[model samples]
Target chain A: MKIICNGTEYEVGQGTTLLHFLAQLQLDPDTVVVECDTEIIRREAYEGTLLAPGQNLELIRFVGGG
Target chain B: MRIMVHEQEREVAAGTPLSEIAASFPGSDLFIVNGCQVSGAYQPREGDGCWCLRKGEMIQEHELRRLLSLRHTPGVQEVISRAVVGIMGLGGLGSAVAGALARIGTGRLILADYDIVDPTNLNRQHFFVDQIGMKKTEALAANLRRMNPYVDLTLHDCRLTAANIPLLFAGADVLVECFDDPVLKAASFRLALTDMKTMGYVGASGMAGFGDNNLITTVAHRPSVFIVGDGESEAKPGQGLMAPRVGIAAHHQANQVLRILLARAGMLMGL
Candidate 1:
């Protein structure tokens, strides 16, 4: 299935979970906020939140210092 | 013949001038009576409803900054003066942002920080040597009060979580994300998008290390979420966090905060 992450498109397995997809991109699940189709995916549900085709996700991570 | 000013009835002679009363309140030249801007010389008639700008209690320093702010942005200082902004951290970003906001005549602030001033924070954070052992919110509050005694402040010396985010910042117009941890920042952002939907949020990210200054800018990813500073300058071993870079990012956050505050009320004219 194809999904848009931060304006870029990518293809992943059909049943890939947000947790797995984030891990594949080297993004730490504990350190990033994920919004799928404009809905926030809580950390506990990341493993069950399946990414559908054409789903748009915004990933934001905080940096160190102020 | 009863005339109201800020809900207070002032006993004056029938022919007493408005300018006389306006002069009593520093920075209060323009006043509205019954929805119309009246001249200072205009005398109030019976049953007049009036509101005076900059009528709040102010000290000398508060009046000075209020004058400068009103001069720089006409009709804006009052709105900002009545607003309450939440500062989530008391380190580099929160402390600097607090000072800037207070100096600009922000009437009230809701500050929450559990950390204490440490020697390491001396490098980039806003703290004096005497405040090394004091709580972040406590020390910053003292400094702010000294700078502007009239500036109201509410301090929350505890860790902020999603459960308490709504309650803690219920009255704040905008929440500034200045946390240094990635997980906490992300968690706060989550709460900002959900619990605090009506409130505007300005967050900091990628403001680490002594990287390119030009790369640092505010990105409005969402209508309510604006991230300041470059999104790549994470503090690593090679590139350490310098005071200049931290100050730059912190100022960017402050600028965004002012814009959001003004824009929220539709008072931001080309600023």
Candidate 2:
């Protein structure tokens, strides 16, 4: 299925959880806020939330530097 | 058609651009339309209102609060005065954000930072030479007091860990993450967003170096979560953080803070 992450389209396998998605992208769950289709997904729910086709995800990464 | 310019309503052509209206009233330092900054080329629709702020105006201290209230959209300053904003870092972005909030009469601020003012921070951080060696919380609090003595401040001079983040900023209406360390920055923001779900989050990333001011911007990851910065620049060996770029991001964070507060108060319905 294709899902949009941070404005970019990506194809992931079926039933791909947000946690696995982050691991594939090398993004630590503790570092990024994931918004799926305009709703912020709770950090604890990352494992249960499945990425659906055409889902618009906004992943805001907190790097550094003031 | 009629549009508001400050306290008075002015008759203007149906599609008169904001630039022409602004030009009619000379010496205005800042222009705000419908509670947000708009380009001068913007064409104001009927019923759209604006405030054209002028600099160097003298007013008594007792009148300061009243004047500030009058300058903004009606009842907006009241919303600002009831907000409690938390700042997690006291570096360039944090300091400028704090200063802007203080100047605008934010009700309270919760400041947390472990570092002290160092000589290298002079290029971007909001500290004077005399403040060197002083804890950032103390130095920033002192400076903020000068801007608005009435604004309440709570200082936590210790480093805010993921464990202490929730407790330190329990009453904050919003939290701004402005850490300089990548690991700590990511950790703090994650903690705030997950642990403090009630408070809005404004985190900055990739605000470094100079040139291309437009690259720095504000993005809403969620309705209550905002991130401001270029999303790519980093303070590396050759490219260091400068005041201009850092200040721009800081102001964006500060503005987002106000917008969130006002939106929560039912003032800015557009947000």
DockQ: which candidate is best? 1
Candidate 2 wrong stretches, greater than 4 Å: A1-30, A33-58, B1-61
TM-score, per-candidate, Cα-based: 0.79, 0.72
TM-score of chain B of 1: 0.75
What C-alpha lDDT values do all the predictions have?
0.81, 0.84
Candidate 1, residues B60-148, lDDT tens digits: the string is 66445535453545467767877889999888889989998887778789999998998989888778999999999999999998776
User: Model 1: how far is B29 from its true place, Å?
Assistant: 23
Could you tell me which residue pairs clash in candidate 2?
A: none
Q: Can you give the DockQ of every candidate in the order shown?
A: 0.63, 0.36
Ten residues in sequence with the least summed lDDT for candidate 1 chain B: B62-71
| Highest TM-score against the true fold, candidate | 1
Task: Please give the distance, in angstroms, between residue B49's alpha carbon in candidate 2 and its true position after superposition.
Answer: 19
**What DockQ class does candidate 1 belong to?**
medium
